[model samples]
Target: MRFFSQRRRPFLSVVICIHDMAREAPRTILSACCPYQKNVSPEDYEVIVVDNGSAVPFALRDGAGLSPAPRIVSMPHPRPSPVFALNWAARHVARGNHILFAIDGARIFSDQLIANTLRAHSICTDAFVYTLGCHLGPSVQMVSTTQGYNEDVEDRLIAESGWPAKPSALYNISVFAGSSSNGFWKPIVESNAFSVPRQLLDKMGGFHESFASSGGGLANLEIFARYVQRPDAKNVCLLSDMTFHQVHGGVATSAKVQHSTFAQEYFSIFQREYRFPSFDAIYLGPLRPEAAKFARIGLAE
Candidate 1:
């Protein structure tokens, strides 16, 4: 009745970061996920959920019936940022060389989620691997709720993307149109998935500790551009396999705005301190990576 295959114990660490989750939301997530964990045999993996400062009611403990009994890593920051929460939780926990960050609000659609991601990483030429991130429809409340199977459900944006039907299925997608969003991945923290060498966390001196709360401005993107976006980076590949990320529009908009402003201001500070040419040069490189084959010519500028 456990999730995962009983015969095989895969090496993986599943990290879920939670903040300001409503009373029912956390239970809802666990309820839906528990069955899948049982069906999939969760013996091989470790699940760690980090509780960031939350304004609303929170369990402060794992809800009853939370199968696999995920470890509760507490971040008592009265007002901690999501980036900080994730970094704290991931810093010393999870045993596998592969680390996955699943948003607390996102439901695990298939038990095969972890299995497929690892399979992709095994074959990837790079050391780090990225799964095609997709949003699960709001109606699905648990992993068992996941129905139907479609490999091409999502369009492939990266050449490495593919459709595989195995222990699970994930629509190959970039959460924000292939742009990075806080979601799942292995060998990298959820907040720093786009970075190469995975160890960039220590190299960058860990998440910008300056920000009081969420929105560590351009910190995430800066790492991505410098580490993962480079053409020569190796051992990293985005999984085209279908994994479902539940979408409930659950993130706190008020909190999100506060962090956005903070992120923007903090990023500007980096620009000023570094004398960078343009904020876009430092922040939104997606718009214009100089080496991009599709760069705009003079008139388009």
Candidate 2:
């Protein structure tokens, strides 16, 4: 069932950076490396989790349910530099021709995310891909949750009888599309779930290392602004998937706008040099089961 029966590189390398997400790391890792994920096999993708100096470092057991278990890296110092953490992990990747970067380690992904993205990437070499990023928490409860999405509420819903918690199925994905620079369906400027070719990632110089903002360098946003509009890049927005964030005391997501001094500083710097992509994505239709390319893995289109 492994994708790499031979010696070829994996289809993708999932790189996740963590600062202090002890509560959410396990869920994030499990979701990404779950044996049940049909989109891509354990052999087809490499999962790397970098713990950037948390009080309690991430520990993995010998036989975690995750096959080809996740590779764990612990940093010595605690710096609010997810940008650096990501590049550090990227440098350590030994396989996988493509890179799947998760800006936040708290995100629990849908099982089909990999399969759907792989299909899109495999078919279109020039398109820039983005899976919808959904904030999980009460709508308007935090700066991050523009809408009601309480994780506890979601958990309660899932725990109920006949709940829709199947990991292999395609999950609800919000589509927001609009025209920009004569292009339709622009990717959200701050999406946390996105995949890019290793070569293209290198071409973009990875995440910008200069920002060093208190809260994640906001380098994730900066990178998207520059590349999606590149004269040569192809922007492709996936309408049937999502990366659900786990509610935590996130720096930007939890902090009040007036209290977000670091974010303000970073934004000032960002605006001085970059113009954000006009729109996140072209608003399409509501969620439907037709979005999933693979029913489970081999069920076929």
Candidate 3:
């Protein structure tokens, strides 16, 4: 079902990819939309959610309260990897000059995410912007889940954090993921939320469809490495912004999977497909008091 907003061409387009996240997608969408995100109007950006063959198709009611509702596209026969679905939206549906990929739909954005992204682009039109990745728990979900953390525990943590009413409070409950363990001062392997110019994305042919592993198996890392390697690209990391991941039995974050075994298989595929590169980013945005503590943690590392 199509629910295109009549807004003008937005400066940014966000393509969120999800597969069987019926329980978590609503909060994720809400966090990226109006009232929750600060200092940005709906006209400034558009969100396109690509449902990658969920058992239960995504419905309009999942994003009911969102103003200028997201464009929901379903891929009934989606490949195991989300690379194809994400690429299809960027190539056909996205109208913004710049496109942001939320490779995991369960991740929620910080309040100033959109405003900070626009500011970074304005600073350098060729900027490749990303935020520090975080998990919505006392520690990374992969570890915390082993300690009995689940969606019910995560929901309680969110309520205690005072989100929406006080969105910055998200920092109180989150920890840097293993990919982002080095913190803001250092480079992370990949970003759950990252953006680039439409032209550049097209030039790179969007995500590499060759990454056919379940949940795109290191596909996000591949794209980030490729984009940052461009001599013309400016890597900007948002110090005050982040994407908080919600636990929903994801391939990498769930206790249901054998983490080491899954990592070994995916890394082997990644190694065969592309060369992994270390990334160092230019930190941007103010170090707000709420986020200052996390910055210190990264620096301490």
Q: For residues 1-301, could you state the per-residue lDDT of candidate 1 as single tens digits? A: 1112223323555666666655324533453345444334465556676666656535535556555566766675635456566566556555544456554434333344444445544555244444333343222322212443122231232123422222232332323212223212222222222222224334434345455534344444444433443344443434323234433333321123444564455566565432211111112111212112212212243
lDDT of each: 0.41, 0.61, 0.81
Q: lDDT by residue for model 3 over 28-67, one digit each (tens)?
A: 8888888788888888898889999988898757566675
Model 2: worst 10 consecutive residues (lDDT sum): 174-183
Off by over 4 Å in 1: 1-10, 23-41, 60-67, 107-111, 124-126, 135-206, 211-223, 235-263, 272-301
Give the lDDT of residue 5 in candidate 3. 31
How high is the lDDT of residue 158 in model 3?
Answer: 84
Please provide, for model 2 over 206-278, each residue's C-alpha lDDT reduced to its tens digit, 9 standing for 90 to 100. 7777767655645777777776777756766665566666666676566533434544656677565444575
| Candidate 3: segments with Cα more than 4 A from true spot | 1-8, 62-65, 255-276
| Candidates' RMSD to native | 11.9, 7.4, 3.6
Q: How accurate is candidate 2 locally (lDDT)?
A: 0.61
TM-score of each: 0.54, 0.76, 0.90
